[model samples]
Target: MIKSMTGYGCGARDNHKVKYTVEIKSLNSKFLELTLRLPKAFSDKELTLRSECTRLIERGKVNITVTVEYVDQTAAAATINTELLKNYFRQLEAVANELGTNRGNLFELALNMPEVISHNEEEADEEEAALLLNAFQEAVAQLNEFRKDEGVVLKQDLSTRTQDILRLLTEVEAVETDRIPLIRDRISQYMDETVGKENVDMNRFEQELIFYIDKLDITEEKVRLRSHCNYFLQALDAADANGKKLGFISQEMGREINTLGSKANHAGIQQIVIRMKEELEKIKEQLLNVL
Candidate 1:
C-alpha cells in the first residue's frame, strides 16, 4: 500500500520526577532529512534518535521536538550555601558598622551574593531515557497511522486519474480508423496535383503509401501505454515502498503519450491525447508525495 510523506504526531509520558513530550512533523522530500530539538542532557543520544526515525520513515523532511518538564519539586530545588551566607552577612555587618549605617536587609543582601544558591546540573539518566524512547515510539506510531489515512485518499485520487487516462486512450482508439484513409487521400491528391494522374505509377505509389502509413502507425505506442498504466495500478497494490518505481512508470507512460500525440494526424485523436496528458500530469504531481 502507498503511504504519504506528510504527517504530524505527538506523544507524552509523565512520571514522578519528569514529564516527557515528543512531537514529530514530516513533509515531502527526496531524501531523509531530520532535525532534532532536545535537552542538553540528551544531546549525546541524537544519533540514536535519528537512526530510529530513519528506520521508521523512508523519506521526508522530519522535525522532532522533545520537551522535558520537571514535575517534582525536589528535581529543580536549589541548594543554599549556609556557611558562605553567614560569612557574607558578618562582613556586611562590619562594613555597615564602619560606615555608621544600619544593617537593614543584611540577610537578603547575603542571600543574593554569588555562590550562596547553586543548582546542580542534571545528568542523563538511563531510566528517564527509556521513558523518552517510549514516548518517541508512540509518536512515530501515530505518524504512521496519519500517513496511512492520507494514503487512502491519495490512492483513490490516483486510481481515478489513471482510469481517466485509460478512458481517453479508448477514445483515441475509436477515432484511429480514420487516420490511415485520411493520409492516403491527402497523398493521392498531392500526387495528382504535382504530376498528371496518367503519369503516376499506381502500383509503386500504392506500395510507397503503404510503407509511409505503416511508419506513422501508433499501434505499438497504444499497446505499451496500456501496459504501463496496468503496471502503475499493480505497483499501487504492492506492499512495499514503490514511489520511485511509480515515478519511473509514469515517465514511461508519458513517453508513449507523447509518441501517440505526435503520430496522431487526426484532430480528434490529438484532442484525446491532450486529455490523457493532462491526467498523466496530475498523477506525476501526486506521486511526488507517495512512498
Candidate 2:
C-alpha cells in the first residue's frame, strides 16, 4: 500500500472567538522538507506542529499555510507592540551586523521576541489554539487520503511496466534457446572457409567451441533477471512501496538486463532486451512519485 508524494488538502474551523484555515501541499522529494507558515501567536506550538507533520507525511517537500481570522479586529490590532518591535528590530540588526550574522530575518526575529506580542498579560487562548490544531489535523488526514488515491494510480502503472519487462524476458528466453547452435554453426563454417575442414581437429574444435559458447551463455543473467523482477513485483504489494528498496531492486534488474544484452549475439534477443530496458526506465520514472 504505497502512497504518492504529491497531494493538496485544506481544513477550516471557525468559532465565536476566531476562525482557522490550514492548507497543505506536497510534492515529490528525496527527503522530508517542510515549510510551515502560521501566525506568530502560535509560535510556542510550532515545534509540536512540525513534529506531527513529519510523523504523518513521512517524506516530501511540504508547504503548510495557516490563516487565522479573529472576530475582533480591533482587539487583534492592539496585540503587537509596534514601537517595541521597531526598537527590537533596530537592536537585532545592529547585533547581527556587529556579529557578522544574517540580518535577513530581522523583522521576523524581533516579532517573535518575548513581550513583543502581548495579550493584555493574559495567557494564550487555549480554545483558539485547540481549534487551529484540530483544523491542522483535518488537513493532514485529507492529505493522507489524497496520497493513498494517487498511490493506487502509481501502483497500477508500475505493475504494468514491470509485467511488460517480464513478458519481454520470456521473449529473450525463446530466442536464446537457438543461440548456442547458431554460434557453433557460424564458427564451424568460418573455419571451413578460412582453413580446409580436413585441417581442423574435430576434438580440439569441439573443446574450444564449448569454451567460446560458455562465454556467451546468458542462462545465469536470465535467471537473476527473472528473480529480481519477481522480487520487485512482490515489493510493490507491501504495506509501503519503499522507494529506496524498489530502486535497489530495479538497479539489480538493470545489471542483469545489461549483461543479457551484451552477451546476446542474436539481434532478436537484443531487441527484446532493449524493450525490457525501456520498460524498466518507465518503472523507475513512476517510482519517483512513490512513497
Which lDDT values do the candidates have, in the order given? 0.89, 0.89
For model 1, how does the per-residue alpha-carbon lDDT over 1-291 read when each residue is reduced to its tens digit? 999999999988878888889999999999998989987778888899988988998789999999878888678677999999999999999999999987888999999999898763246588888888999999999999999999998888988998898888888888888889899999999999999799999999999999999889999999999999998888888897467898999999999999999988889998899889899999999998987
Which parts of model 2 have CA positions greater than 4 angstroms off? 79-123
Q: For each candidate, how many residue pairs have backbone atoms clashing (under 3 Å)?
A: 0, 0
Candidate 1 stretches greater than 4 Å from native: 78-122
Clashing pairs in 1: none
TM-score of each: 0.86, 0.83
lDDT of 2 by residue, 1-291 (tens): 888999989999987757889999999999999999988778888999999987989989999999877776654554888999999999999999899998889999999998898763143478878988999999999999999999889988988998898889888877777788889999999999999899999999999999999899898998999899999999989876688889899999999999999999999998998888899999889888887
TM-score, candidate 1, is 0.86
Indicate the residue-level lDDT of 225 in model 1.
97
